[model samples]
Target: MTGNHWGYGKDDGPTIWHKNFPVAEGTRQSPIDIDPHQASHDPNLGPIVLNYDHCTSINISNNGHSVVVEFDDSDDRSVIQGGPLDNPYRLKQFHFHWGGKGCHGSEHTVEGQSYASELHLVHWNAVKYKSFGEAASSPDGLAVLGIFLDTGDDHRWLHMITDALYMVKFKSSVTDFKRFNPKCLLPSSLHYWTYPGSLTTPPLHESVTWIVLKEPITVSEKQLGKFRMLLFTGEEEDQRMRMENNFRPPQPLKGRKVRSSN
Candidate 1:
């Protein structure tokens, strides 16, 4: 994490990430376009299970990349299992990638069609590794559940998050946010496409096992506008750059099998 300052700008964008983190060019890169018809349905893959009833949500912050809501992963109170996972992955945090007014911003797409935004619920293999940092570099270390967000009617619970956006409108800003359950963000269906992939961000470790939902949630344009109000630069910086289009484009599938659980 030293000597590497990567951002979604012209000078420090994705194309040159490999200069700092060689793994950015790894074979299992993520944010790939999923073709439902091409994905192989796996009867062996059971329904994914999520037990987040008593999840301990910590605080929310703007980390220059996206607005992140971190959770307490000291225990397995919030965990996702089944599907392609042999063991449960402990929920750590959730973040969003979005675009500026009326632009597509989702990291992953389907049939080459992009969405307005994308949400990534990141988790780590706590059972196998002692800590998230240790697991983050391993091949089977992380599991990120990605959900798409489209512009439409205002989402029921999304306002709960958007309303808090002002508290962290600048990079490195944080505020207390507790007792929030992410289950409210999920779509009705649990069907997903699972594959081996890497983190979309730098130190682009090829350690993530991605599970992308087939269905997308709806949010209003006004609601998404709140996110754009935030800035990539800190409050002290002279220039204020609007935070949008913070998503990496689709990478090469590289012969990876995308297994669908339907």
Candidate 2:
């Protein structure tokens, strides 16, 4: 979870992922260009929680375009207890979104505006886990927690894993990370915008209850620069072939209503 060894470097890079995973056909992805004028009403949302706490198996990887700190060190899954998810779910993965500079990478638009990056805390309802592969094909199988990011502080929260950057890369590895509580990164206020949507990645399975936190967290420009130093592996050849932009575009609010727990 902490070491920053993973990324699109020279060796284990995106080109291979493209070959193996190629974008799933008809998958709803992220990073779409939105026009602010398209803002819509946010309805009333249900409950949410962060379940299965105590321990986690963390992973740091270069997901093509940006570096992500994925939660769940192993099969031991941690808990996040509640928000707008309606039911209890298991914390699975946490990843991030970034841009060449600032001004992009978030899935939802704010009154039509986008931000530099976004962090997603992905979760899955335990009831559906016995067969998540199958359940994921539907709308209620997954739950994703979103947090917006902007420029400012150095984001000491990231220090939670910053020192680990020296560990795994090109050849992804896992480690025993300490008390890195995801909740610590959350703003004191829990105000959020909720909606029914699909995973913002391939397989774009429409199995999600998305909770977008209202307050955005800040990370310094220097901290962000560290991401660029990541290498899928070693060398220019491998670096040129890393995974980037694994995000799915937003689906039509398709007459679908968005609920908020403000």
Candidate 3:
């Protein structure tokens, strides 16, 4: 379960993750199915605000699990506040979880319905926590904005990321991806469903305050196909595994009330 041994394969997938990361079965685990009807509407919940105009995107890389775009979080240049957050959380990185050809792969679902993919923009509590690693372990230390991706017409700004996917196709590969602001990837509406949940991947720490957008961004099948081309294995590895279906299924809600922004 250590050092890239865990994967989407039958033997090493989410079903077996609990053997290593015991918290995988924790009460507040994430990627839960969001039942809109059951979610309580909070009248006092303010609209979530994102200030990413000055975000310094550093690089894009393949980390054997998913493709991640890392940002320079040394300062509070870019952060997310309002909504359920008490303070502005510093933006750390963004990544995607997707399925194979012609399959739905989103982590969190709406009323049991699945989307083609999910995008996670991760942030940390810089005011209270000294480092991202420290923030990731404490409850209420992280905030992750989840956006669903539906297949249809092409997404105008998504091409900026997809165009560079070829450069980091293999695991551990990284390339310079500067000056690319993720604000362009957002939908017009900021309406979201908020909850207290954990990370969807390994070390599934229950620290994140999840804000999942109600609106889904559209991208063409051709664009999604580009992500499928990425390999989970490194270039030197003889057995090349296609990086697809890289999503953990929805976890139990555990009686936690999901709140919706008005």
Candidate 4:
């Protein structure tokens, strides 16, 4: 798994990830199935607040794993607070996971039902840690907001990112993508399910305080197809691999209690 050798293929997929990153089988691994009926509703939980009014988005890139839109988190310009968080977490980057044609590919499922795609807004606890890398390894150092994307009418704001997919179709490609605010990607309701979990990808660090929104945002198949056009292979590679079904299946709950926002 060193030097980005891992992928969603038969030989090197999620199942075999633990061989390299043993934390993959950790107790708090993410992308767990969220059972609404089993989740306890917490009236004490406050509304999740996102302050992206002055957010500075720098660029977008294909990092071999997913298309990531990075931000300049040097200051507290854009951050998420309230809800299950004790302090405002600085927005670092956001990426997505999706399925192939006519397939559901969300990471975290609802009552075992999967969505077409899932969006992750990664934030670091700048108040406690000095850097994003430090925050990622420590427990309670990160907060990832998960938003499910269902198939339907086109999302007007999503085109901003999808339109740029062609520029970074190959892995390790990057291009200028400034002033794009992710606030537009949020659903109508901030009501969500909260739990302690790890990253869905490798190095499955169990440091994230997960906040998954209840309502799903709708995006047309046409828009989602734009994501599929992206290639997991680099431009130099002879083998062409379409980036689809990049999501990890739901992991075992392992007695973890999911809490619902009031």
Candidate 5:
């Protein structure tokens, strides 16, 4: 009903991204399929071993279709070994990529296929943004650490995310459970897909330096339904099914490159 927290199938479908938020067009996006022809063999990048400690209570917000997480003070120590030592990027926000009950939801398909959902650990170059949105225009402003999702039996895996789904449904709604860390959500292996791409959502800002994990974490069907519950109610009056297909349409390949850590 309001300007924010749009699930899927509404007037502002994921495809009409650029039209909804004029500023979104200015920010880098994700969930793009990689073109093998353009995918380069960059020596500087490989599987990034992330060493994050502060979780800051994995808070989520429904920015129309997908949810975005805001990390309190998360950083990246997984930069390419010989690359920049002090990672100027600070974990700013995060979100997910999901499919229906029984399918893939990954953004970058492996040889043309999607996963059930992908978890994006979005960060901003502190060297750029005094505030999160400040660096929306800078090409090197964002660094997104992506992890894949699969079905699993451990309920602990959903602890940080599923618990806080209700608070951030709409704009200006904040949820803080307690002090937490980000390292717990990750697995032992850090293999991933790296690339330079635009935002998967509208406005399509091309400022993100992405690192997508090769391995995926699994969740039970009941778990994903909880995420759907995040947007079940709208504006205190419009209580429609708010979680219908909140995925963004794939973007034009437009001459970019993708890298991998496998």
Candidate 6:
């Protein structure tokens, strides 16, 4: 089904996703609650290596669901390796999911506690797969780095994004956003939880090897408020629905093991 057909509404929410994408009912579904005490500590799991020093960040856009910042992945200039991956995965794009003010908007939870929002840095296994679309459906195709966002003082560089929200208030709107390396957005620590999970959005492909960070980044409440200003509908559409609470609730663990890095 098309993205427009599925949304965070009463009639089109996660509860009914199984009807459209059968994989929604899969055993390895994503956004699962992370219980730190239950997770196994693997000494073999090395620290994840991110080589984004010279990464080429392109433009940012609003895709009706969330605001996405695209990157140029033509070469191996921007790639992630080590940890749970056998080969380096090329960085594709990054996006955020959030809720209305004063509510949790994160897709995944820690000990059943949800953060204000979540950040997903999507990458594809360019070595094993030729294209991102091809990799997105395979078992070992993608790696998503999830970072939690909490309400606090304004982030130092987040204004570079929130300031540009006015340009892409409507769906499918995009603008130039050059040289913005996402490495600046990462938390101080790279210690994370790793697992095999599906895409939080539809098709709900079980192709992602999730690496969720333990620490959360702080962003002011005013910055998050800017996200709510985006409209889910096009400018021509008569109905205006503000975009908020765009995250999917955590799914069942289904006996999948969560590995932690040292």
Q: Count the backbone clashes (under 3 Å) in each candidate.
A: 0, 50, 0, 0, 31, 0
- Across 6-113, the per-residue lDDT of candidate 6 in tens digits comes to 988898888998998998989999999999999999999999999999959999999888999999988899999999999999999999999986888999999999
Give the TM-score of each candidate: 0.97, 0.73, 0.97, 0.97, 0.77, 0.97
Q: Which 10-residue window in model 3 sums to the lowest lDDT?
A: 1-10
Candidate 4 residue-wise lDDT at 100: 91
Instruction: For candidate 5, give the lDDT of residue 17.
Output: 51
| Candidate 5 runs further than 4 Å off | 1-7, 18-29, 35-38, 46-49, 58-64, 74-86, 166-172, 236-240
Cα distance off (Å), candidate 1, residue 72: 0.5
Best candidate per lDDT, number?
3
The C-alpha stretches of model 1 lying farther than 4 A from their native spots are 1-3, 236-240
Better of 2 and 5 by lDDT: 5
How far residue 161's Cα lies from its native spot in candidate 3, in Å, is 0.5
Alpha carbon lDDT at 157, candidate 4 = 99
**Model 2, residue 84: displacement in angstroms?**
4.1
Off-target runs (Cα >4 Å) in candidate 2 are: 1-47, 51-53, 63-77, 80-84, 171-178, 232-251
Clashes (candidate 4) = 0
Which of 1 and 2 is ahead in lDDT?
1
lDDT for predicted candidate 4 compared with the true structure: 0.93
In candidate 3, how many Å is residue 73 off?
0.2
TM-score of 2: 0.73
lDDT of 2 by residue, 130-164 (tens): 54555566667777788887778888787665566
Candidate 3 lDDT by residue in tens digits, 126-181: 99999999999999899999999999999999999999999999999999999999
Error of 1 at 185 (Å): 0.3
